[model samples]
Target: MKYLMPFLGLVALLACRGKNVEGKNMGKEIVEIKKENTSQGVDTLSQEPRLKTFKGLADTTFVRLADFSDGFAFDLRYATENNFLKAKVYDCAECYTRVKTAKALIAANKDFLDKGVKIKFYDCYRPNSVQYKMWEIVPNPQYVANPDKGSIHNKGGAVDITLVDMQGNELDMGTDFDYFGKRAYHDNTDLPEEILANRKLLKETMESHGFWSIRTEWWHYNLSAASNDKVANFKWECND
Candidate 1:
C-alpha cells in the first residue's frame, strides 16, 4: 500500500493525526525520525545486502556522486588521498540517502545550476566512530549533544554541503567545513546578505526534496524518509 508520510522541511516538524472508524481527528502524534532505523534491515531498493565494513568511502553505481551537470564526482578529500575523511578516519558511506534524491534536486532546479550554483559536499557518509569524534570536539549541549548519542551522519542520513561555482570554485559560506562557531547556524544574522542568500538558496532547494538542515550548521542536511523506515537503523559496511 502507498503510505502517506508527513513532509518535514529543513527545520519545521510536521504533526500527523489519523482518523479511526469514528471519523474523528486523532490526537497529535509526534513521529520520531531516527537517523539509523530501518525495517527488515534491507537497502532501500535492491535490498542488496547492506554494507557494514565502515571502511574508507568508495562510490559504487548505487552510491552515485553527482554534480550540477549530473556528472559523477568523487569526494574531494578522497580524490586528493585525504585518508582521515575516508572510512577508517571517517567511514560513513553505506547509509547514504540514495543518489536518486540528488538527481531529483538537480532536476528540480535546473536553472540554478545553469546559473553556476553547483552543489559542493563537505562531508557525506561518515562512520559512527567519526561521529563520536565530532561530538568530542564540540560536546556542547546546543551543538554536538553527546558522543554516545551519535548523529545522522553516522547513519549516512545526513550530508554536510555547500555551493560551488561553475568553474568548481567554492563559494564563501562565511565559514569553512567543520567551522565551530556561531556563524554556522541558519539563524545567525551577523553574516552578510550574500552569505545569507547563498545559504537560503541552498536550504530552500534541499528542503524542497524533503531534506532537513541542522540549526547549528547551514551545510548539514538530514534526509527524512530517505529509507522505508523513518530512521537509519540499518547497519552498512563497504562492499569491497
Candidate 2:
C-alpha cells in the first residue's frame, strides 16, 4: 500500500509538470501572434508613398517636380488665363524646374509642412519663348522681364509660390498673385498681422533653402545657385 501511494504521488507530479508545459506553450503562441501583428503594422507603414531621390540627375537637367514629390499643390496661372495677361500661354499645366532648384524647393516645402502648411506653386520654370509672349503682352520692363535678357524663371531657377493649409486653402498674403500694386510688395508691411506672418513664414523657409526673394514680388523666389544657368526654351509636351 505504501508503494502504491508513492507511485500515485509521482503520477500527480508528472501531471502538474505537463500542465505547466502546456501553459508555457500557450504563452509562446500568444507572443508569436503579437509579434506577427506588429510586423504587419510596420510593413503597412513602410508601404506608404515615398518621395523620389535625385540620384543620377544633373543640376542642369529639368524634371517635372510632381514626379519627385506628391506633397506640393500647383496652380499654374499662365495655363488658365488667370494671370495679369488674361491669356493661357502654356500648352498645359506642369511644374518643371532644374534638378538643383527642385531639390531646394522640396526641402523648403518640407519645412513649410512642419508648420502645418505647404508651398502652392503659381508658376515654375517658364520657357524662354513664354517670356517673350509675356513681354509682348505687358511690353514693360516693370511688369515683365525682356526675353532677350531672360528672367531667372527662364533658367528654371525661379518659382512663384504661396503657402496653403493641408486642406489646400491658400493663406492670405495681403494680395492676390500677380497683383501689380504696392500691396504685393514684400516691404509693404502696412498690412494685417496674419498676412505678414504668412509671408514671413514663406520667406524665411525659402531663404533657408537657398532661395532669395525680390522686393517687388513676395511670391517670387529665385535659387541663388541657378542664376548663372543658361536660359532654356525646351517646352514640356501636353499629354492629349
lDDT score, candidate 2, position 235: 96
lDDT of 1 by residue, 1-240 (tens): 133343344124322222242234222221112212245453443554333331343322124333223532234442232433323343343224445444444453464576666676666655555556555654575655354655655455567677777777777888876566798888898989998888888888888777888788887787674433222333345455
Over 4 Å off, model 1: 1-62, 66-88, 91-96, 99-111, 133-148, 227-240
Question: Across residues 133-188, which tens digit of lDDT does each residue of candidate 2 receive?
Answer: 99988999998999999999999999999999999999999989999999999999
Regions of model 2 farther than 4 Å from truth: 1-51
Q: Clashing residue pairs, candidate 2? A: none
> Judged by TM-score, which candidate is best?
2
Best by lDDT: 2
Error of 1 at 29 (Å): 74
